[model samples]
Each structure stands twice: as C-alpha cells, then as structure tokens.
Target chain A: MNAGRPTGTRLHWWWVVGAAVVLVAAIIAGVMIGAVRLSPSQVVGSMLDRLPFVDLDTGLTVRQEAIVWQIRMPRVILAVVVGSMLSAAGAAYQGVFRNPLADPYLLGAGAGAGLGATLAIAYGPNTGDWLVDPIPLAAFAGALIGVSFAYLLGYTVRSGRTSVTLILAGVAVAAFLTALQTFIQQRESETLREVYGWILGSLNTAGWAEVRLVAPYVVVGLGVVFAGRRLLDVLSVGDTDASTLGVRPGRIRLVIVIFATLGTAAVVAVTGLIGFVGIIVPHTVRLLTSASYRVIVPLSILLGGAFLVLADIIARTAVAPAEIPIGVVTAIFGAPFFAMILRTSKAVVS
Target chain B: MSTVRFEKVSVDYGAGPVVSDVSLGAIAGEWLAIVGPNGAGKSSLLRTAVAAVEFTGSVMVDGRLTTTLTDKERARLVAYVSQRPRYPQGMAVFDYVLLGRTPYMGTLASESTHDIALVWEALSALRLEAFASRDVATLSGGETQRVSLARVIAQRAAILVLDEATASLDVSAQHEVLEVIDALRSSHNITVVSAIHDLTAAAQFCNSVAIMDRGLLVNHGAPVDVLTESVLQEVFDPSIRVLEVNGDPVIVSLRSEEAYQ
Candidate 1:
C-alpha cells in the first residue's frame, strides 16, 4: 500500500501545489495591473489594513483604496470562486460519466442561466434596484430548468443506463435552450445589447453581495462532491463495475449530476456562463495527474480558480484603457491549450 | 454455504433462445466446468445465473431466486468476471482490482482502512504487487487474467462464474490459471463454474462437466462419462482420439480428410 502511494500520488500533490501558487500570483496580478495601476506591495498593504485589527501603516487615497479593495478584490475573488465551482463541477460530471468530454455547460446550466438573466433584464423594473440582480437570479432558475430538461429527456430514452444517451440528451436540451434565449434576444431590441454583453461574460460589477449569494451554493456542491470522491472513483470504471462494488450507479450518478449542476448554476447565475474553464482545466489537471478521483477533484478546484484568476488579469491588462470580456480572454487561451492537450494526451473518450 | 441452481432456464437475446432449458446446480466446494463449442450459449448460462441477462425459468443463488434479491445482493453471492474487460487506458492495476470491493462498500461510504488492506493482500496473492501502479492496458494477456482473478477473489463471493477467462493465455499460463482456480475452489469452497473449450484441461480440473451444443445442453456427468468419444464427436463435430496418460484423459483431434491425404 505504501509502495503504491509513491509513484503517481506525489506527482498529483506537486501539480496541486504548483496550481495553488500560480493562483495566488494570478490574484495578485489581477489586483495590481488594472486601469489605475497599483503596485503589488500597495495592494497587499491596503488589503491588510482593511482587515479588522490588522493596521499596517500604509497611507492611501480613497480612490486607490476603493479601486483595490471594493472593485478589483471582489471581482477577482468572484472570478476565482466561479472558476473553481465550474471546473470542479466539470470534474464531477466527467468522473460520474466516465467520459472525458463531459462539461457542466453541456447539461443546460449555461442556457438556463442565460434565460434567467434575459427575463430579469428585459421584464424587470428598469430602476437598477440592488434587490433585483436579474442576471444571477435568472441564471439560477435557468440552470435548474436546463438540468431538469436534460435529465427528463435522458431518463425518458434509456432509463439512466448509459452515458451516451444522457450526453446526447444534454446536447439536445442545450440546443433548445440556446434557441429560446436567441429568440428572446431577437424579439427585444431594447434588451439585445444587455443580453449580448452578459452572454459574452463579465466580472465588472461583481461585489460582496454577489460573492455571498453564489459562494454558499458552490461550496455546498463541492462539499458533497468531496465527500463522495471514492464513489466517483468507482463510477470511473463504469456502471456495471460500480454496481458490483455495492454502489447503485444510477442513484449515485443522479446525485452527482444534481450537485454538479447546482455548483455550475451558482457560478452561471452571478457571472453569466463563463465557458472553456470547465472543459479545459479539469482535462489538463487529469493529464498532469492520473485519473484518480481523490487527486483530480481537489486539483481541478485549485487549478480552475488559478486559471480563471490569471485569465481575469489578462482581460484587465491586455488592452490598457479598456477591459476585455473575461470570457473572450478565457476562450482564446483555453481553446488552443485544450487542443494541444487533446492532441498529446491519451484521453479516453467513450 | 448454500448451493446455486438453474432450473429449466432459457435465455434469449432478441433472437431465438441462446441457452435453452438448461438445468444445472453447483453445490458448495464443487468445481463444475461447462464445456462446449463456440456460440453454444455457455456464456449466456453464466450470465443468467449472475442476473446480467434476462432468462425464463428460475435461477437461484443461496436458495433465493436471483431476480428477487437486489442487484447488489445477487452480486455478493455470485460475482461474474467477464472475458477481456474493456478498460479505460491509464487505469492502475491496484485500482482496477480494488473495484471488486465495491459490493462491500456503501455508496457514500469511504473506502475504509480494511478495504485498502484487502486490496493490497489480493494484489500480493496474485503476484501483481510489483505491477500495482502500472497501467492495466499495458498488462500482458496472462497478467490481465491473474489480475481479474484477483478481483473475483477479492469479491469474496460464495459463487464464481468465469466466461473463458483463461482463453487468451498461453498453454502454461492456462495451466497456472486452472491451478489457481483449483486452489480457490478447494480452499475457499467457492462453487466454481467456468466455460472451458480445452477438453483436456477441463477434464484435468473439473470433477463434473456439462457439454453444450447449439444453445442446448447435450450431456452432463462426471468427466469420464460426459467426455466419451461419442459425446465428443456429437458436440465438437470432430473425430477426436482420446488417450489415458497416467490415469488422466487427454483428447487429441484426428486429422481432417484434406490433412490426412
């Protein structure tokens, strides 16, 4: 047992540690390199002084402090949280299905969230009241709707026997949701730009309220996944094999699907469906490490958070005066890197 | 401690019957070899007992109808080890074998210290300790057979059903696997049921044999009686010569008309 622990296990831990370090650096870079440039030391000092009972002697103007503490910090933290949730959910989906191609978006979370945001923006009172964050609320509802349709259609066809039929059902549901969201956008000339910009994905208006609202759901979903890590390992073998091990593969799969959807929904609600982070980060982590759920689960979480933070930094600093859509930056980097990984790694697709 | 019985069981897979009116029983500590030609429903019979395939008539494990118990309960009593398992690449040998313990684990239950220890012991016993961290896809045919056997053994099941498990191995590897099966049957008192094509090897290991032809069980008896020349000719459709060397029956196929000329 001890002998078995050395070879692949050490490499997984190293990768996780490396990903964590990079995430911290990315967060710092994200805060330091925004439009009104602040040094890393100043950002750090400002943050430390803001914390209760930790008075570091760093004098700063109100504008610098607000930009660093209120704007960039919450936004960066939100990006990390959302990224970690989506990637970890993707890992859970892949592990449950035993298919490397599985992602949270494939299940209708993104589409549902899109519809939710559109309805809130197009129909809600135009006063911009703090109480009505339509996008996140709509996203949460849309995610639930999407997953329900996916599950309903999937179960209707095969009774939850194979992953193939389920994934296909997800594809159909995603297409349907996308079509609905497009129709809604096309009909409303007033809400078209708002819908388009939100769909492009952003962390611009993220605040403590958004962070607090989405964090609990994502954390709970992740907790459920972590607690069921061993079960996911059994699932990686396939349903029949998992059943022989004393797990009801269908029931366990349903649980995972629901939890993963919940996590993805939480993030999509706040950030309006950031794509590629879920698909790329988990696959990259799996390649760097073996397919053990124990290792992959936590590593995907940390690496995913780091990847999003780094991407957010690039989004803010790439064009000096104007910030690019975080989603655009993520896709540009994630697509090429994902292709390279796919070309090189022997990823098993069933 | 209870025996398994298949009474007038017939399995059909959207076609006509694959296994027709098959009645067989495996008592505790008995090694029963189901011998037959290819496509003769040998695999179907084993799968029916494991409740993997639908079948008419009764299939009982531990005196209870297999259909009555949950899938998990049936698995605990009778474990099926498929031939040439299709595995995702990069799966370590230890993890693959550890799946056998799934029947004993709860859905949310963590793999306890005991489960890990059992997996280690199984690996050592199969002499796969050295290859624990190696990818299962990289294993040779013989090594794969041993690893699968180790998994079944880890299942700690009362009844074991193997479907041409050693068919991919070399001659010596075949004997080694049979030897391991013999040890498992004798030591653990597991009711061993295997579908073997090699008549001589089947005769050497099994106390009882059931011959299957075209989805029908043609004959079943002790090895000496069921393995006679007439039965061999009818089932195998070959004029085989049987010789007794050191009181053990060894079957040799006679040359065909073209080869003989």
Candidate 2:
C-alpha cells in the first residue's frame, strides 16, 4: 500500500468523457424506449426541430408532445437534481470524515429528512396553503433540524469530537427520531400511510415547485463545500497535523458538516431519502477518476445527476400504470452494482 | 531567532506527571540533545516544548509565551518531526515533505513553485533526489526517516525538535542523516533538540547532553563529563568501560563483570 504514486490509478479526464457519453446514451434510451416505443429517427428529428434555436417540425404535437415535455422532462430534471445532490453530498461527507464508509445517511441527514417530512405530512396539509407544498417545506425543516442536532451533539462533546463519534451519535439520534416519528404516525391512520410511503422514498410526486425549492439550497451548499476543499485535504491528515498545517479542524469540520447536511436535507426533504446515489455513485466515479476534490466534486455532480435521470427512466417504465418506490429501484440496482465495483476494484480505505 | 526557555515546566498525561518541574533553555543556533533510556520522558519533554502536547508552566519562544501564541505562530518558530510518521498511503514523498511549509501557505494558495523548489532542495540535501516522485508509503524505514528529515529541513524553522528521529535507520543512514543535520546547524545556525537512543551517537554529535531517568533530569553537561562508568551503571543497570579516543569519550559496554572490570 505504501507506494510513491497511488495504486491502480484511473485518469480523471477519461472518466469524464466516458460519463458524458453514457449520459447521452441514457437520455436517448429514456426518451425512446418507454411504454410506447418511439422510433429513434423520429425522436431525434422531433428533438432537433422543437429546439428553441432551430424550429423545424418532425410532425406530431398534441399527446406525444405533452408526454415528452410535461411528463418526462420534469421527472428527468428532478432525477438529475436529486442524483447530483446525493453524489456531491456523499463525496463531501467522505472527504470530511476521511473514511470511505461515510455517506449522506451516516450523519443523520436521511433519517432527519424523513422525520421532518413525516412531521410535515402530519401537520402541513391542514395549514390551508395547497400552494405551500408542505412535504418539501416540512422535510426541509426536518433535515435542517436533524443535521444541526448532529453537529451540536458532536460539537458539545469534548473528547468525542471525532468523525467516528459524530457518526455514532447520528445513528443514535436517527434511531430515536425514527421511533418518535413512528409513534406519531400511529396516532393517525391517514398520516401513518403517508409516513410509511415517505420512509420508503418516492420521486413521482416531485414537480417544478419541489425542484425550485431545493435548487437554491443545493447551489449554496455545493458552493460552500467547494470553497473549503483545501481544508478537507488538510483534514485527511489527523487533527494534530491539520492544526500544524494552519487549518482549524474544529471550525472547518463544523462548516463542512453544516453545508453537507444542508444539501442532503434539502434533497431528501423534497424527494425522500434516495439511497446509493450518494454512496455508490461517488465511489464508482472515484474508482474511474482521481481522488482530487477539484476533479471529484464536479464530476460526481454531473455523473450523479445523469445516473438519477437514468434510474428514474427505469423506475417509470419497468412497471407501467403503477410506479415502484424510487428508493426500492435504486437499492435493488445499486446493491449489485456496488458489489461488482467492490469485487473488481482495489480496496479503498473506508 | 528562537530562544526556547521552559520555566519549572510540568507535563501530565492523565494518570500522573511524566515530566515534572523541568527547566531548560536553548538559544538560537545551539544544539541540545536529550539522551536517556526507555520511558525516561525524553519524547514527552520535546513534545511539550513544541506545544504539541499540553504542559503546565511557561515556555517562551522568541520572547513570546508558547501558550499565548496561536498554533500557526508557534509552528512557524518551531518544527517537530516525529519518528516514523504514519503517512497516508499513496502520498508522494515530495508532497509529504512540502507539508513542512504548510504554516507559511495561505488557506487557498496551492503549493507554489518556490515551495516546490525548496522541497526539492531539502530532498537533495538528504540525498533523496531520485525518490522525490516516489510514494512515501513505499519507502523503507531508513528512507522514511530521511523523508521526515527533509520535511523539517524544508520547514526552515528556527528551532527543530526530533524525537528519536534516527532510531529506525541503519548505522550508515544514521551517519548520513546526522551529517546533514550537522551541516544545517553550521550553515543555517538552526537550533536542534533531538532525543537520540544510541549513547555513542549522542556523545559524538551533540555538544551538550541532557540525561534523564524516571521523568527527572539526571545530568546536564558535556558528553565527556556526563558519560562515566559509575553513571552508566547507576542509570542503565549495566557497567560499561569508558575509553578516551583522541580526547573524545567512547563508551564500550562490558559483556560481563569479568570481561572488563
């Protein structure tokens, strides 16, 4: 393991090119191979003619047009956003903890969002603002609370300020909060079903409003983490080294934890707790690319977004007329894919 | 200029005191070596002096109290190189050495060409020019020690603290490293405080030796005066024949009482 250069390295630029190609192929597959198999030529011609820059018609508008634009486009966009957010958050969390096992879920972001969304479902619909979209707002609030609680708990302890301690505390908090949510759900039948469904995670109901709500938080959170990439590098060395290297590990960790949790919370608040995109996607990308934050951060974002869009396509078309929980589909596919990656790839210190 | 003075310093690592009421001073360009047996608190004293470990009492460096100064300022004045640092796998040897310059770098500023050049110079001084591009993880024990030395050299700090820095290396590598350190002291006038395990190496290299036993300073004097048969017997529980070679002391440990006494 002690080598001058990292072992079995993959060139980062190559991965970017490959990811771009895969993304394009996935998009085409997503559009053309739905319940109704549209011809590839027609699909391409229609896409080109309908382009805002070049207005040429490939024929057929009404029903076909609505299906492509309103139905398919929004879902695709949501998938991309959720995917990118999870992947970026995963990468950030892993960097901060300096452990490969750390993902968005490890720090209570997922459970907290679930708890937040559950509370909102229990209380929000009665507030008389159908325009307000309680699920996203309440889930956002829950996510913020969960993340802040984890940070506060970790920060408060003097000797237990390690990333390991933070994760353990988060797990405890998640368990307690999940139990409380369940107890609250038991009190009402209608809300119990909502809670059950929310915990399982779904992206079907996500719309433009949900998308708009998460966009700003995601952008700001990503920006904050990106700015602190250097600090993350210092942190990879132990705390003592980080201090000697002119970085205040305590403050840097606090900021990173906040930004990462916020992004995870925002995405989970809107789309529930989608798994694997955060944990699996970043690892796959890292295996293909360099561990350099300058490359990994942006690549994970793009690749994650693309992965989610592709996954969403599978979710929608796999069982037409009725959709499976997006979480189930991601877990089902991600488990084997992740295992394969592990089997083929050299061990990364998790 | 680094003027390190510890006044009645005491270091306690939880259970009890490891170093108690120890007072010492090392001026700029002075090299002071602390030589002692195992569990003598030599490492603790050095760590406490650099403020890497907590200690009670006053430590003054360049006229400012160590406790009062920020970590960054303290790091600028003193650089500590621990024996056999556990480097991250795949970290380049050059990059590991360049970490010495971390205190000088800005939060966002990438390692500049000047920093890299200095790192290279440090590597070259240690005769590790060919290993610059190699990973630190792949290095042998001797090579790793030299890499750690290069980092401290690149640090270019006024005061250098090494905790048994050459213990892990072979005799030849030890001499090679000590020679480089000797050159640094003469040319740059950098003050060095090292905890050396080999008594002969200490006697040959260090101008002044501070011997410790059971967390207390036993003797502080020139190696010729401090290193004696009775002192060795009392401290080490073994009798050694002290020989005078060209007016310098050479310690020869007796295999048994009949062999020399």
Candidate 3:
C-alpha cells in the first residue's frame, strides 16, 4: 500500500531504516530554515555538546538556542508525535475494522475536539496560562466523552459490539458533535475565523506545555497499540476465525479502540484536527512494503512522522510568513495520494 | 487421547436456535464429517466447538471444557479453518501461516526462530513452500485453502475443525486438499471434525458421518451405514441417490431435477 499498487510482498528492514532517516532529515530541516533561519552546524553541534562524554561546538549564542530548543524543537517533536500517532492509530483502526477507509478519527475524535475547541473560542475565558487553557482541556475531555458514548451505544445496540455497530455509533456521535460545533460557529460568527483556523488545524501553538499535556496519553496508547500489533493481524481474519484461533476479538477491539482513540484524541486536543496522515500513511505502508501488521504499524509510524514534519516545513515556508494550515498541506498531498492508491489497489476490498 | 466432545450443546443466535442439544464425539485420529442440507446447523454446531458462538451446555476438547481453558490452552488443543478463509490483502503466504503460532507467542512478541521453522514445515507439509513468499491474495481458491490448512497445521493443535473446506474448489483441487488433510490426520494422529457439503467427499474420507436435520443430529454411523437410501431420502430430497464404487459408497452428488425423470 505504500500509497500505490498493492501487489507487493514483505516489508524490508532497510525501508524502515530509510523512513527513520527521512524522519531525522525532516526533523533537521524542520528545525533549521524556519522564519528565523539558523545555522545547522551550530544547532547540531550545540545539541551534541549536551550529550554525555561527547563534546562539540560551532559557536552558538543563547538567543539562537532559545529559538531552536524552545520554539522549533518542541514544534517539530510535536509534529513527530502527532504524525506517528495518527498514522499508527489509523492503521490499527483499519486492521480492527478491516476497512482501508477507517482512520484515527473514525470514532468521534475530530468532531468532539471540534465542538470543544469551538466552545472555548466562542465563550471561554482568555486565560494567559497555557497550562490551564480551557481549549485543549475541553477538547480532550470532549473527545474522551464522545468515544465513551459511542462505545456504550454500540455495545447496547440490539446485535451488540460488532465493528459495524461501533462504527455506526461513532458516525452518530460525530454527527451530533459536528452539529453542535456548527451551531456554535454560526451563533458566534465574530469568532468564525478563529474557529476556522482551529478546524483547519495548525501546529502554530505547539510548545513544551502542549507536548507535556499529550505525552502521557500518546505514550501509553501507542504502547498498548504496538503491543497488540500481532493481535491486530489475527483480528483481521474476521471475528469468528480469530476467535477460533483463541483471540478475543471483542476484548481486543475494545482495548485498541480505547488506546488508539486516546492517542488520536490527545493529539487532536493539542493540534486541532489534522487529516490524511491517519488514512493515507498506513495503507501506503501496507501497499509499498508488506501487508503484515508487523511491518505496516511500525513503518506507518516512521513514514507518517516524516511525512507530516516535511509537510509542516512546506506549510510554514510555502507562502513565506503567511502560514497555511498544516491540515491544508496534508490534504493537498493526501488527496491525490489517496486516489492513486484507490486506482492501483484492487486488494483494498479484499 | 486428545478428542472433541459436545455434550448437549445448543446454540441460539437470537433469531432462534440454530443448533439444539447436539451430543457428539470424535475419537483421536478419526475424521468425523458433519453432513446436512443447508440450514441444518452444521456450521453452528462447529462454531460451538471453537467457541465462536454463544451456546448452552458444554464443548470439551481432550476432556477439558473449552470455556474453562485459557485462550492459549484452547488454541493448543484445537485449530479451525473457516469456510471462507480471509486472505489478508498483500500478506505473504509465509507470514499468514506464521499466524498459526499466535498461541505460542507472548502478546507483544514477534515470531521466534522456532516459530519460523514450524511455518516452513507447515508450508512444506501442505506442498505450499513455493508460494510462501507470495502474497496470499494471489493464490487460487485451492491454494488459498491449503494455505489456511498449513496455518492450522503449524498451530500444532491436536484437534482440527473445518467447515466446507473444499466447497469452493474444482474436483482436482478438492482431492488435492483432502489428500493433504487425510495425510495430516493419519500421520499426526490429529482429530478432525469437519462440516462437509460434498457428500461423496464426506463419505470417502470421513471415518463416520453425522447427519443433521433442522438443528438435530438424526443419524451417526459409518459412511456405508449412514449413506444408505433410507437416510439419504429422509434427510435430503427423495430423488437423492447413493451407489457403491469399489466397495466405497458415493452419493450421486445431485438430485434428479424431476422425480418423473
């Protein structure tokens, strides 16, 4: 699925290493050449000086260090975390749901975050303290609440916690949240531009505080997901067959849904709703490399992180100071990429 | 001996009871085929053995209640091949068969060297080693079914269960798969319980046949005894015929379109 024809075989280790290099290069590029262009040698040398027993120097001042570490590093790291998380979550969701179209936000992450962010924009106090910011906190709470309700509804439905039921429940909850978000946007048209920016998504607000806020959830969620990767492969074989193989499909789904949504919701809380990384990256990895989740999940993480960070570089640089929403950048790239995959891969449905 | 037994097992999937109080057993190393018309609950009955469906009563493999066993323990005892095997898109055939080691792996663990070796052995056993590196989706129906069997063989489960394992294949492929299964059963001394749609194939390979009619097991005996005219006419259409070939009973595999004809 490496975003094209899927008539392929095993994912090579070299490709994974290549993806890692891409991520590292993207990070290096993203850190340098921003609004205030900084020297790469000085930045890299200063970072190497901090390493234990290894020393290096290329003459850096305190001001540049602040710009690199405080502003750029956190922002790039956030992009890596958010990007890798979304892609991994998306791949996990697709495997659990067995639908290539499934994504990290398939179960209420986007809509819930939208409604919360909208509410904060329209009526919340303009607190200077980013620590207690109502916007991200509200978004986080809203996302968790929305997914919980979806799970509950799907579980209680006549047939019970089938993937279809969970998906339908997600759709319903998302619809309701999106409707509420729209109403808020309409009633407070004065803040429509602010709301629109948040909806379109950007990493402009990324800082150490935002990173700290999302780190725990993302870490725990991704750990659970990575651990369950093999189970996901088993679950892809359908519930009955997976059960016959001694996999508890229902339990595994619940665990994955809870954790993957947690990670997606955490990132959405901070980054707003960036799209395409979730849907495009995983399938692309699957097609290009291997269908095995063992390969897909890990590769999706690296490539997804690299892809978004590079997209972020383009986003901030393309228009020169008038930054396009990072979501817009991803969509510009992801839409055509998605189409190519659809055209070339007959195995998407299989 | 490791065996499978269902003691008064009944399955009800909300609409109604699909299988009702089925009491049956398969001895170790024996192939017991469940034969019935569509809707006679063969699938549902098989589902209980794998714990794929909710059911009342007991399904015991190797004298232990399947419900009481851990997932790993149950997996070690029984392996199943579905009627419609999900050929996960773009998955290498070797990787697909490696999934059979799920029970042996830690939750977060990748397959070990031993696991890889077993997969190779399974692939060779099924005559599928050549296709190991190929995508599972590229295989023909017969080859895909063999891949499925190889996965189960790698599982090392003492009991093997299949549902219409060869229904999708041509005659040659059907025998090709059945022969491998027969070889597995005889060589490994594995217990096999399969719901077979092909009556002749069922009669040819199975040690005994259990005939189901509307969720009840009405007859259970050797193929020669159970494939008689009286049983065939009662369970299937009256036009259904059975004949002897080289001392082996073969169902005609068809019903006369018109009773007059």
Question: Which model, 2 or 3, shows the larger lDDT?
Answer: 3
Summarize candidate 3's per-residue lDDT along A1-350 as a digit string, tens digits.
11231222345779878988988888888888787887767767766887899877657678888888898989999999999999999999998988888988888888988998899889997757555778888888888888898888889998766899999999999999999999989999999998999888899988998889889988988888878888988988888788877778999999998999999889998898999899889878776666778788888888888888988988889998799999999999788977797688755545
Model 3 chain B poorest 10 in a row by lDDT: B251-260
In candidate 3, the residue pairs with backbone N, CA or C atoms under 3 Å apart (3 or more residues apart, or in different chains) clash, namely A1-A284, A1-A286, A1-A287, A1-A288, A2-A284, A2-A287, A2-A288, A3-A284
- What lDDT is reached at residue B208 by model 3? 94
Q: In model 2, which residue pairs have backbone atoms overlapping below 3 Å?
A: A2-B137, A2-B138, A3-B135, A4-B134, A4-B135
Q: How well is each residue in A223-249 modelled by candidate 2, as lDDT tens digits? A: 877776656656766676566555677
Pairs with steric clashes in candidate 1: A112-A142, A113-A139, A116-A138, A136-A269, A245-B102, A245-B103, A246-B102, A246-B103
Q: TM-score of B chain for each model?
A: 0.96, 0.93, 0.97
Off by over 4 Å in 2: A1-69, A122-131, A158-160, A182-193, A346-350, B13-16, B37-40, B67-70, B167-180, B183-189, B213-216, B227-261
True contacts kept of each: 0.38, 0.22, 0.64
Full-model lDDT, candidate 2: 0.76
TM-score of chain A of each: 0.91, 0.88, 0.92
TM-score for candidate 1: 0.87
- TM-score per prediction, in order, is 0.87, 0.84, 0.95
Docking class of 3: medium
Which structure among the candidates has the greatest lDDT? 3
**lDDT for model 3:** 0.87
